[model samples]
Target: MTVLYGIKNCDTIKKAKAWLDNAKIDYTFHDYRVEGIDADMVAEFFAQLDWQNVVNKRGTTFRALSDDTKASLSAETALPLLVEQPAMIKRPILVHQGQYHLGFKPDQYAKIFASA
Candidate 1:
């Protein structure tokens, strides 16, 4: 099974969910706002995927971070920040089997899911 992790209200997440449903793909949704993500889980995700892929620098949540905080972000710094703020991580992290995908792009999902 695949796991789709993101906030329920995010338009990107909604699109991702709808795409998966339309494609007849099964996925489990993980809402960070309601459930609150864990540091350990973030750390584990980092371990499995590249730090750059896991972090969402383009998001408003990232832009709103303190300059010092954003400037000092190394992989180590990023992991904790992402844990404390799940929004810092990219939206709609799709995990299937042992592979991980960050963000939701229709073409990208098509490529990935096609292989699955």
Candidate 2:
């Protein structure tokens, strides 16, 4: 099964969606913000992903956080904040056949699908 997780409005997500559509790969999209998130889902996201990669430190969401919140960020502390604010998570995490990938690139998508 192939699943894509990200906020719908993200430009990166749009690019990934377009790439998938053009590639004719069917996938399920999980918008963590609107659909909400649970511990299991969050845990699954972190299974192969590092907190630094999973968290979008460059985005406004993360930038707006209090210094104390930012200072103490870690694997243990990230989950609760991710549950409360999914935007803090990076865009377009593509999971294919149980393998997880973060962000989007045409070449990367092509390679991933080609391997199938």
Tell me the alpha-carbon RMSD of every candidate: 1.5, 1.0
- Score each candidate by Cα lDDT: 0.87, 0.89
- The TM-score between candidate 2 and the true structure equals 0.95
lDDT of 2 by residue, 1-116 (tens): 99999999999999999999988999999888778888677777888787778889999989999999999998889988888889998888999998999999999999999977
Candidate 2: segments with Cα more than 4 A from true spot: none
TM-score of each: 0.89, 0.95
lDDT of 1 by residue, 12-116 (tens): 999999999999998889998888888788877788877878898988989998999888888888977887788888888899876888888999999888977
Ten contiguous residues with the weakest lDDT in model 1: 43-52
Q: In lDDT terms, how accurate is model 2?
A: 0.89
